[model samples]
Target chain A: MSETAAPLAAPLFDRVAIVGVGLIGSSLARALTHYGVARQVVCADRSPEHCAKAMELGIVERATTDLAEALEGADLVVLATPVGAFAEVGEQLGPLLRPGMIVTDVGSVKQAVLRDVGPHIPDGVHLIPGHPVAGTEHSGPEAGFATLFQGRWCIVTPPPGANEGAVDKVVTMWRRIGSTVELMDANHHDRVLAITSHLPHLIAYTIVGTASDLEDDTKSEVIKFSAGGFRDFTRIAASDPVMWRDVFLNNREAVLEILQRFTEDLTALQRAIRWGEGEQLQDHFTKTRAIRRGIIDAKQA
Target chain B: MSETAAPLAAPLFDRVAIVGVGLIGSSLARALTHYGVARQVVCADRSPEHCAKAMELGIVERATTDLAEALEGADLVVLATPVGAFAEVGEQLGPLLRPGMIVTDVGSVKQAVLRDVGPHIPDGVHLIPGHPVAGTEHSGPEAGFATLFQGRWCIVTPPPGANEGAVDKVVTMWRRIGSTVELMDANHHDRVLAITSHLPHLIAYTIVGTASDLEDDTKSEVIKFSAGGFRDFTRIAASDPVMWRDVFLNNREAVLEILQRFTEDLTALQRAIRWGEGEQLQDHFTKTRAIRRGIIDAKQA
Candidate 1:
């Protein structure tokens, strides 16, 4: 991630296994090896092609389609698949988990991870859910790199009364990969991300969809002149459809609540424009600039 | 500008005057000098501070508060003020324009430029309205650079029965300054840009405005976790308020029309999410990805 990270003195885990070796999963695998955070990093993916690509790219020491084989002797198991696959994957992964093993995930919606995978986790195995707020529009194993988590925030949501040691290890691993770690409740994390991540994506998808439905001539011009602003939305809308679908389906309540608020604000602005209320529009835009300034000061800009 | 552009054989215009030296205006001034497209670049601004800043930055050869002073004997006059000021500027500019002088503008909405500035142009003066599909969120003279329009499209909307020689000169100047020129009707240009530029800015401003209205605790979290997606909207929403305000006010019809379509599509997607229609969401998201590819292929991404 950051060029200034100090070299790791020792591996944090003896054996680490990542499921669904796509963008985030493969990036984690690369980061673990690149930073020497794991003695051995392996991955299991539903797509054999991704497993082959991960190994071919030397991102992981071992790659396989079989969940049990990949999880064998893994002290740390990361479920990096889409949230929709968690229940089925969790059912198969439960018996494979050994006592003292720590299981975590990097899904967008954290509460769903708890609802889908929490019950399937055996009593002795730790199930700590985490979401790293970092990724590109690209997906699949080849799209990942070692520094994807560098300078990014990783929110780890450990269940109530969970093992402190297990939570600490997960936090430490993220830190070793150059991420700042924050711990929050699963419900709160979902609410925050619905506004910060999910709603932006949904709006982007909707706008891009609107453009695509325009008359052919206008649609082509939209693509031609997209450098103005629409191109940014296109990039966001280009993100993995399956992953985003699961994000919307799983985090319905929070996303919809925030989306309603967004709609109300939009309608107010639309009214301002219709009525030629320049002062109101300018004031709203002016205040938002302060938030951008705050974000820059926070180093998130 | 692309590294492949050939050195200019000679200056395209002598004594170029740019009114309202803000972000796009200052950049154009810089580009005219950097590419040796103008023999001398001068700017006029209502704000004395901006005029001084432009001179301090060496973006213009001469900067003045009086539009007439800046346009003195200039062969080319570029109206670079916000569209909202075009009518007032045009009223003042009408008598000062010399015969055979080519007048153009760099506004976001084309029809508004024609409506506001068109009638004031006298006989023998060419009125060509243009919109450069480029810019950053930054504003003011200091925020501009010579390459802002490089590899971007410049839509030139010349009225019927306009002088061909004047049109060619305007198009040539844009090409010399590192832009691809496309000629179209003013009405069509407004509609194209309504979807491509104005609508995106409106949505971004709306969403960032929504985030700004959140409670303090959640607001801080929005900034903290902004990297997920909201950060991009913040960046877009950080654009100059007055300029964007003018954009929405002038381009109301097209912007509102496209906005209605966007809201309708969003409602459909919202319903699909509420109903747990994963297939519909995935299919819609998947199709939008193709438009991103189209942008990338157009070399506009």
Candidate 2:
């Protein structure tokens, strides 16, 4: 069924407040307005420059540095700031929230959303934590495009006993904005992303750091010859540092668990290379090829 | 200076033989013909199916499994096979080679080319190891395209006292095919590529394998939500397994050295994440971002 089959006259949310105008937040605002899901979009960002850029881009009807002003008269409030700032933002937002308002988020780590922001939610408010599994290495309001979420997955991990109507509304909004929505447990979401997202970013950052520390002559050569494979890691490593810092800190246990497995796997391959075990290296390399094919077949590649 | 400004009317070689009708070989063959660089192109492959595909695609004038037959009347012979097979292939071709023929290769590792194939070169024959730093995740002759090397670097590592005339001819041929050529020491080339290319591939293969070995239910979710960062690694891991297997095996010392540094760096980041040291994580991530900017400014991004 088409989630956007609603008539053109209908606006899913009369007033939607986006409480961070960075890449994900700006992109969400653009998508919501482009899909006619929100009659009015207001964004709050700590950076005055980002707020002004969002306004100039016309992604929202209003932009401000005041979190309370942005939340005024908004039935849907999205906490799109970095996860590290969620607890403080939650404290400031609690007094501004009204009964029946729905609160959601775009943090990478899901469980942290509940731990940081859940207590501040009003008794009658609905809390549904979400993660839009899509982005480029680029960040900021200008880096965001309206089509960033197209054909991507948006995972929603609503807290237990979340109002069904609020969850359905959020799902419909995401679907209308061109994401396939998946409902998952918060802890399970963290585990899966630890492998799929967090671990990969960690590896990319490490390798890029290694390259940067090379002798000056060798460093230039690395950049010139990077098209071989290093360039891909550089792009991943270019992702927003503050956001990733928060992700690693908030999802420490899962990320560390996966990192340990990755380190062990890497050590075995290292040993294979050290011992001239061509068959072992080839066998492991060959097995990984099938996973790539699976991802391509799933339209995720 | 503009490399391709040379008039297209001049053919760089009378006849060229490309050993191994795979992605790199076929693309070089197509570029030779597309730019009128070779009067005739011949290809040799162990796979009859690939030979047939090369012939049907018109990328080569002749295709055969017999290396000697393919090299007949060819002034330029390019060994484009996996590095592990070079010693045997070199032994076979050494008897068939005539004096003054320029033998170049597109191997990822340079020192290995000299070690495995150096002794096989006949007196007066030129052996210049060339690595064109470009490729997609795809492989095989059908995956080859004429524009693969355009604007990419082709590093040529020639042995001491190599014939200057032969080196100039090979450099001119690569230029005609739209590559910026750089001359470097073979040992240095291996070390640079070890960090820029080999280590990244090793890391990618390990991470992809880690994700693949997860519990089946979580594995599917990892693939489904991979756009976050893992998808990029999967693309790199999807690269030809046999080709990469030989790379790690042939360039063992350099690859291991770089891998050691990478492991230490990763462990540092892992510790920071485990201890919730957001500043340390943020600082390292912030430093890596500069390398990406350098790649972009260099037009390699």
Candidate 3:
């Protein structure tokens, strides 16, 4: 490993293990190599084909199906698999983790991370759960690029009494790869994400599903004339199915809570439309427009 | 007016009058000028400032508040106002239209166009209602550009037995301005748009409305973390309020119909989430994924 780390410079991990070489994992590998954030990235995947592809694409220094082998010498282990796999991966990696090693993850649902992966971490090992609020509709190793995380927010939910040095190390690595890291509690992160990410995705999937159930001709026409607003839902609905499925399953309570509110709001809007209440419809639409402006002002739009 | 009209080339009208100088209308004027689709473009707006802005921005050759003056000597009158104003605009322009003139509109809802404007056309004149399935979230003359309609679909719903010459003129003009025009009945257009555009916008507005009602601190956090999925809805909700309000009001029947289906589907998903039916959620989400692929294949995503 390179040893000339300055006070503010990013410290290179001797070996970094990235579990599940999908879009997020492969993207982290690419960014680490591109920025020299780590000396070596070693990836392990359950699918041998994905491991072969990762090695062939040169996204990592080494690729293997043996999780223990991949984590043998790694100072930083990032579990980039779907949240549903966190418990199993954590159990597998727990016995192999070395003292002073940092364990992080890129899971959308944060509370699940603490619940699933927290208990398995050994003493002296840091557990920093992160959610990089960035992605595209595409998935897999081939779909990832080094610039995927640039100018995006990465929320880190480090456990209480966690090692500050380890958290700062993970933050520095993310910063080196061009992400703004923000710290928040896992529960708050889950709730905020339920509204902003999970609920929106669920609604998009539902709308697109409704459209898909239409007659063939009408469905074709919907696809043809999607430039209106349905196309946006289609894009969001196309995101990685496994990841989203795991998201809904893991973050069930928060998702169900927000979805209940969405349903009530939609039902009210539906009644207003049916009764031709133009004033009410216009009022709600106009109020929503203000929130949109605030998002643009916040530079997140 | 320039008289160098080739059989299939050159200006389709001596003068084209646009009733509103917002994004769609201004973009149409700019495109007409850029492609020489009309010899002169005249604009009228309820706001005197908008008219002046349109003229200053060179989106129209002439601007006026008097709908009568704007329609003077114009062989083609385009009612580019909100759908809610079609009836009033139609009534105002009915007596001013010259014989054999073509009256059209760029509104999202088509049935309302027929219901409001169909009776206003004078003998020997034609009403060819159309909607260009394209636009950004921005509004006003300054937000428009000459190439806004390039490669987009424009649906024209000409009345049965309408003047063939007028239909051809509108089709030729749209083609020259970089739109692929498709002819369909007005009622069918409304039904198709209800599913594709109106319902999606209504849902987006409702979801964003839900987010807006969050507590002040949570609302601010939602805006900051909006890049996840809420950002897309914010952009959609940021669309012109008056225009969308008009859409929901004008296309009440079909909007309510499609909205009913969407709400039912959302309820099913909500129930699935509440019951922790992972398979049900996965099945629906997976099915929706294909529709997105179809949209991308159709080049609309």
Ranking by lDDT: 1, 2, 3
**Model 2 C-alpha lDDT per residue in residues A1-301, reported as the tens digit of each score:** 2355345637789999999989999999998888888999999999999999998999999999999899989999999898999999999999999999999999999999999999998889999999999888889999988888888889999988888999998998888888889999999999999988899899999999999999999999899888888998999999999999999999999999998899899999999999999999889988998999999999877
lDDT of 3 by residue, B1-301 (tens): 3222233475767899999999999999988877778889999999999999998997788999989889889988998888999988888888898788888888998888889988887787788888999899998888998889889999998888877887888888888777899998888888888988888888788889888888898899999999999999989988888898889888888888888898889889888877778788888888988998898898776
Query: Per-prediction RMSD in angstroms?
Result: 2.4, 2.4, 2.6
Which stretches of model 1 miss by more than 4 angstroms? A1-8, B1-8
Better of 1 and 2 by DockQ: 1
Q: Which TM-score does chain B of candidate 2 obtain? A: 0.96
Candidate 1 Cα deviation (angstroms), residue B298: 1.6
Per-residue lDDT tens digits for candidate 3, residues A190-242, read: 99999999999998998899899998988999999999989989999988877
lDDT of 2 at A274: 90
Give residue B276's lDDT in candidate 3 (0 to 100): 76
Clashing pairs in 2: none
- lDDT of candidate 1 over B90-162, digit per residue (tens): 9999999989999999999888888889899998999988888889999999999999988888999998988
Q: Worst 10-residue stretch by lDDT in candidate 3 chain B?
A: B1-10
Candidate 3 at A169: error in angstroms?
1.2
Can you tell me which runs of candidate 3 are displaced by over 4 Å?
Answer: A1-11, B1-8
